[model samples]
Structure formats: C-alpha cells, structure tokens
Target chain A: MKIAMPDGSRKEMTVSVARIDEILKELNINPVEVVVAKNGKIVPEEETASCADELKIVRIVHGG
Target chain B: MLNDLEKKRYSRQIRLFGEDGQAKLKKAGAFIAGAGGLGSVISIYMAAAGFGKIRIVDCDSVELSNLNRQVLHWSDDVGRSKARSAKDTLEGINPEIEVEALEETISKENIDQLLSGCSLIMDAMDNFSTRYILNKAALQKKIPLFHGAICGYQGQATTVIPGKTACLRCTFPRAPPVTTFPALGSTCGVIGSIQVTEAVKYVLGFGGLLENRLMLWDGLSCSMDEVACMRNPGCQDCSALIGDANYKQEMSK
Candidate 1:
C-alpha cells in the first residue's frame, strides 16, 4: 500500500490489517486527525483494506 | 418588494441573482455559532450580503492575541465580549439587517432557543463538540448547516442539508483531538468565504452546494482538494431526519 501524507510525502507499506481502522490502529494513526483513502476512494474506517490497497492518509487540521 | 434604497444597496448582487434571489437573501436568517476567526469572517460577509438576520454568539472576551485572526475584534476591543464586539462590527457593515449578539456559550440546553426562527446554522466554533451540537440542532430543526474549520494554513468546509446530505457526525463519527491549533487569518478567510458561498446558494435556491464533500484548502501548496462523504446509515445525530417528511417541509419555510 502507498501512504500519502498531506505534506506531499509518500511512502509504501505492506498492509497487515483487514479493516482500515485496524490499519490505522497498527500505524498508531489517530482516526480523528486524518482521513484514510483507499485506492483513491474515501471509504469509511470500518471498510476493509487489503494488502493491495493504496492508502492515502490526509490529515485533518480542525480549528476555528 | 425592494425599496429604492435596498434596490440601490444590493444592485451589484441583484445583477447576479436578480430581485427574487436578492429578496430570498433578504428574507433569510442565520445563526452563527462563534465570534472567532471563522465566525468573524462569516458574519461580515453574510451581513454585507444582506442576510435578513444574523445572530452571533460567543461567551469569551476578546484578547490581545486574538487580533491576528478574529478580525471582528481589535486592540480597542481586547477586553470586550466577543459577541458584543462582533455585533458592533456586523451592524456597522450593514445596519439594515438585524444583528443579535449573545454573550453565551452554545450548549445543548440553549442551542434550541438560540437558533429559533433561523433558517440556517453556521459552524464557526473552535471545537468539534460544539460543532456536533450545532449539527444535531440543525438536523432536528431541519435547517441547513454550513461547516468550516481551520488550523494553521489548512482549512476544510462542508455543507450539511438535513435529509439531503451528510451531517457532520456522519462525516466524522468521532471528534478530532483538541490541540493548540495555529491559525492564519487567510485560512479562515478562504474557508469562511466558502461557507458563505454555500449558504448564499442554498438560500437563493440555485447553483451547486458543497453537499456530501469536504472541501480542503492547503495554503502551503496553493491547492484545493475535495473528499467525498456520505451519510452513515446509523448516524446517531441525523438518522431520524433521513426519512422524515417534516424535514423537507421545514426546508421550504
């Protein structure tokens, strides 16, 4: 899977989890701070993410 | 009917939307939930655009540090309640419209009374808990919610039309972690303007609203992106409105 950060950095990772939330948990990613898009589609956290999925992590910067 | 002065006052925008559209704007009201960075900008534009009524609430007092982004307050207003300061500025911008400022924190207890008779809710708060409150209130009342948030050079906005689009809770089932967020006034400007644009289009009954999509602005890259969103079938806040006929009925009011 490909990890794309909001800052334009990209990295490759082999998925080790079935669900997006699990992958997020494995990466210690806070679900509230970032949105995970799998293969260019924004899926809900509970949706499945396979080893072949390309995950893009977009950070959500919430303030006023 | 537009009086000669109102016709003259909004002549520029009238050209864009015509007398009926201008009249739609003039007959609508909005409840803005904060007086900080996003609230200040949203109220200013909504008032200047001739929104019939603007009710802005905030419990905090202006601080010297707030002048950078909370443009409604200045050095002279450092110690004044943000709501009052916002009212003064918004009224000065367009006295023809009603500007009601409340020096109260928005909560579940007071949200109903605070938004009564308003046609729309604007989420300009600094926190998500309050944004969620605003979201539920909008849903229950069948009013639209124009959402916007910012930190540092990045900001995001989305519109929630009860029963028609994704509610805030559906988009983020959990609240974002609270942090000492850095905010630039320009980021607020970008997001706030998008909110007002969606709101105006909503009231005017034309153009494409920012429904079911979160618009993201990244100043560092000078680029914008949108993430698609959909309503959660089991959304705790707004599922009741999904199939309610009253939701559609109230929207036409």
Candidate 2:
C-alpha cells in the first residue's frame, strides 16, 4: 500500500500491522503528533488496518 | 457608512470586492489570543484590511528574545506589555479600526468573556492547551476560529467552523510535548497571513475556507499540502453537534 510519509515523501511498503497504533509505532512516530488516514479516510489510532490499505500520516506538531 | 477618509483609505481593496465587501469587513469583530509572532502579523493585517474591531490579549511583558519574531514590539518597547505594543502598532498602521489591548491571561473561566462580542477568533496562541480552550469557546459561541501555528520552517493552518467542520480537538486530541520550539518570523508571517486571509474571506462571506483541510506549509521544501479531516463523532469537545445539517448546508453556500 502507498503511504505518504511525514517528511514530504511517499513510500510503498508491505506491512503486517493490523492496528493503526502499531503501524504508527513501527514508524517510530508519536501518535500525538500525527493523524493517520487509511485509504483517504481519517481513522482513529485504534482502528484496524491491513497491508492492502493505503495510508497517510499527517504530522501536526508545533502550536506557535 | 464609508466616509470620505475611510473610502479613500480602503480604495485599493474596495476596487476588488466593492464597497459592500469592504463594509462587511468593517462590521467584523476579531479577537486575537496572542501577541507574539503570529499575533503580530495577524493583527497587523486584520487592522490594515479594515476589520472593524480587533481585541488582542497577551499577559507577558516583551523581552529582548521576542524581538526575533514579535514584530509589534520593538527594542525600545521591551519592558512594555505585548498587548499594548500590539495595539499601538495596529492603530498606527490603520487608525480607522478600533483596537483593544488587554494584558490578561486566557483561562477556562475567562475565555468566554475574552471572546465576548467578537464574531471571529484568531488562534495566534503558542500552545495547544490554550488552543483547545479557544476551540471549546468557539464551539460554544458558534463562531469560526482561524487556527494558525508555526515552528521553525514549518507551519499549519485550518479554519474551524462551529457545527460544520472538524474542530481543533478532533485533529489534535493530545497536545504535543510542549517545549521552546524553534521559531522563524517568516514562518509565522506565512501562517498568520493565511489566518487573516481566512478571517477576511469568512467575514466577507466569500471564498472557500480551509474547512476540514489542514494546510501544511513546509518551508524547507517549499511545498503546500493539505490532509483531509472530518468531524470526529466521539470528539469530546464537538460531540454535541453531531448532526447539525442545516447550519452546514447554509454555511457551505
């Protein structure tokens, strides 16, 4: 699945992670700093994901 | 009621959207929640654009460190309150607009009072905790909150319309580890200017807003991208308005 990485880049990867939280964890991303979208739909971190689903991680840090 | 002086002063922009659009701007009241980097730029543009009433609040006194991005306060005004300096600068830029400068900290108790009479809220705050407060107040008051934030070379902005889009809490449920993040005046300029632009369009009743879209500006790469966001049904802050279809339909037009 195509995943839009946070550094303004895109990468296609095969992953076995089932839950969105684990996918973020595997990427070493802090969940607080990003909103993960699965197949163009925003999902909570607890939602399940599969290797066939495309994902995008949008980082939302820095408040000022 | 564009008098001779006011008409001449705003003539350039008046040529674009006509006097009625300018009048809509003149009738709008905007509240800015900070007086630092983003606030400096946001208030300046809002005042210059003829946004009728502007109230800015900041509890801190200016220091030498703030000179880097707080354009409203100069070296001579170091010891003075940021809110006062902001008022001085904004009034000086455009004497036609009313400017209220308050030296007060925003809290849950006073958030509603601070936003009273203001039709729009400009989120120039430096932290998410306060942004959350502004978000809740905006939802309760049913006003649009123009959210802009910056760090180093990256910045983000989104327009939160109460009952219509995903509120700030929906996107940023947890505050990031707050620390002294690096800042640049240019980044604040880009983001804050966008916030003012959003406020102008919102008040003038024209242009598509950043609703449900998080605009990410990456200065390092010089790219602007947006991610779609939706109103979280289970969001603690905005869950009350789960099905406000009428407001959404009218506002979308």
Candidate 3:
C-alpha cells in the first residue's frame, strides 16, 4: 500500500490491515491527532483503505 | 443609503460588487478573536474595505517580539494591550467604520456575550483551546466562522458555515500538541487574506464558499492545495445539531 504523508512524501508499504487507522499506525503516525483523507474524501478513523487508494494526512496544530 | 464620503471611500470595490454589494459589506458586523499575527491582517483589511462594524478581543499585551507578524502594533505601543492597539490602528486606517476592542480572555461563559450582534466570527487565535471555544459558540449561534492558522512557512484556512459545512471540530477532532511553533508574518498575511476574502464573499452573497474544502498553503514551495472535508456524524461538538430542525432554523437567521 502507498501512504502520502503531510510533508509531501509517498511511502510504499506492505501491510496486512485494511482499516485506515491500522495503516496509519504502520506508518508510525498517530491516527487520532491527524485527519486522514482517502481518494480526496475525508474518512472516519474506522474506515478501510486499500493499496490503490490515494491518501492525504493533515496536522492541525499551528500558532496563529 | 450611502453618504457621499462612504460612496467615495468604497468606489474602487463598488465597481466589482456594485452599490448593493458595497452596502452589504457596510452593514455587516464581524467579531475577531485575536489581535496577533492573523488578527492584524484580518481586521485591518476588513476595516479598510469598509466593514460596518468590527469587535476584536484579546487579553495579551504587546511585546517587542510580536512586531514581526503583528503589524497593527508598533514599537511605541509595545506595553499597550493588543486589543487597544488593534482598535487604534484600525480606526486610524478607516475612521468611517466602527471599531470596538475588548481586552478579555475568551471563555465559554463570555463567548456568547462577546459575539453578540456580530454576524460572523474570525478565528485569528494562536492556540487551539480558544479556537475550539469559538467553534462551539459559532455552532450555537449559527454564525459563520472564518478559520486561519499558520506555522513557519505553512498555513491553512477554511470557512465554516454553521449547519451547512463541516466545522473545525469535524475536521480536527483532536487538537495537536501545544508548543511554541515558529511563525512568519508573510504566512499569516497569506492565510489571513484568504480568510478575509472568504468573509467578504459570504457577506456579499457571491463567489464559491470554501464549504467542505480546506486550503493549505506552502510558502516555501509556493503552492496551494486543498483537501476535501466532510462532517463527522460522530463528532462531539456538532453531532447533536446535525439533524435537528431548530438548528437549521437558527442557521438561517
């Protein structure tokens, strides 16, 4: 599966899990702290993502 | 009816939206939640563009370090309250508009009172704790919230239309860990300008609203990208009001 990180890097990984949160965990990302989008649509933490899906992650902490 | 001075002041923009659109801008009231980096840009542009009334609140006093991005506060005004400094600067920019500055911390108890009479809210806050408070108030009041935040050379902005669009909580369910993040003044200008533009579009009833779209800007790369957003049915802040008819009616007000 391929995961697109927020820093604009794409990582190709082989994982056994189908859920988005599991995949994020495999990428060493904290699923609870970032928003995940699959194929341009935001998905819930429980939604499943496949290897063919395009993913985007956004972190919301910033000092205004 | 616009007076002679009002007509002349807004002539340039009147060409784009016409007199009625200009009137809408003149009749709107906006509440800004901060007077720091983003707040400085948002409020200044709103005032210069002839927003009829502006209410800005901030409890912090200006310091020497804030001068970089906080354009509204000057060196001589370092010891003054940011709210007072922002008000003075905005009034000097456009005396025709009304500027009300309050030096108070925004909490759940006083959010409603601070936002009273304001048609929309501007999220210029540096921290997420207060941003969440403003989001809850916006949901309850059914007022639109213009959200903007910045860190270093990266920034993001989104427009929240109560009951119609995904809210701040829906997008960011958990706040990122608090820390002292580096910020650049130009990044604030970029995000804050987009926010003010969204507010103007909302008030004038023209152009496409951000809705469920989040705009992310990377200054280092000079690129702007968007991520699609959707309302979370299980979101704690907005879930209860999702299907309620009373909430819909409140939104229309």
Evaluated with lDDT, which candidate comes out highest? Answer: 3
lDDT of candidate 3 over B1-253, digit per residue (tens): 6789989999999899989998999899999999999999999999999999999999999999999999999999999999999999999999999999999999999998999999999999988889999998998888999999998998989999888888899988778878888989999999999999999999998899889998989898899988888988788899889578976675565
- CA-based DockQ, model 3: 0.72
Docking class of 1: medium
- Candidate 1: tens digits of C-alpha lDDT, residues B1-253: 7788889999999999999998898899999999999999999999999999999999999998899999998889999999889998998989889999999989999999999889999999998899989999988877899999999999999999886788898888778799999989999999999999999999998899888888889899999988787778788887776567776564345
Q: Residue A54 CA error for candidate 1 (Å)?
A: 3.5
TM-score of chain A of each: 0.75, 0.82, 0.79
What TM-score does each of the candidates earn? Answer: 0.94, 0.94, 0.95
DockQ score of each predicted structure, in the order shown: 0.70, 0.62, 0.72
Rank by lDDT, descending? 3, 2, 1
Error of 3 at B235 (Å): 1.2
Better structure of 2 and 3 per lDDT:
3
Choose the strongest candidate by TM-score: 3
After best superposition, candidate 3 residue B220: deviation in angstroms?
1.3
True contacts kept of each: 0.69, 0.52, 0.72
Backbone clashes in model 2, listed as residue pairs: A64-B150
Q: Write the per-residue lDDT of candidate 3 for residues A1-64, one digit (tens) a residue.
A: 6677878787876654488887777778887657888888778878988767777887664688
lDDT of 2 by residue, A1-64 (tens): 6789878788776776578888788788889888888887678999888778889897775656
Tell how far residue B85 is off in model 2, in angstroms.
0.7
Reference-based lDDT, residue B234, model 3: 86
Candidate 2 regions exceeding 4 Å error are: B243-253
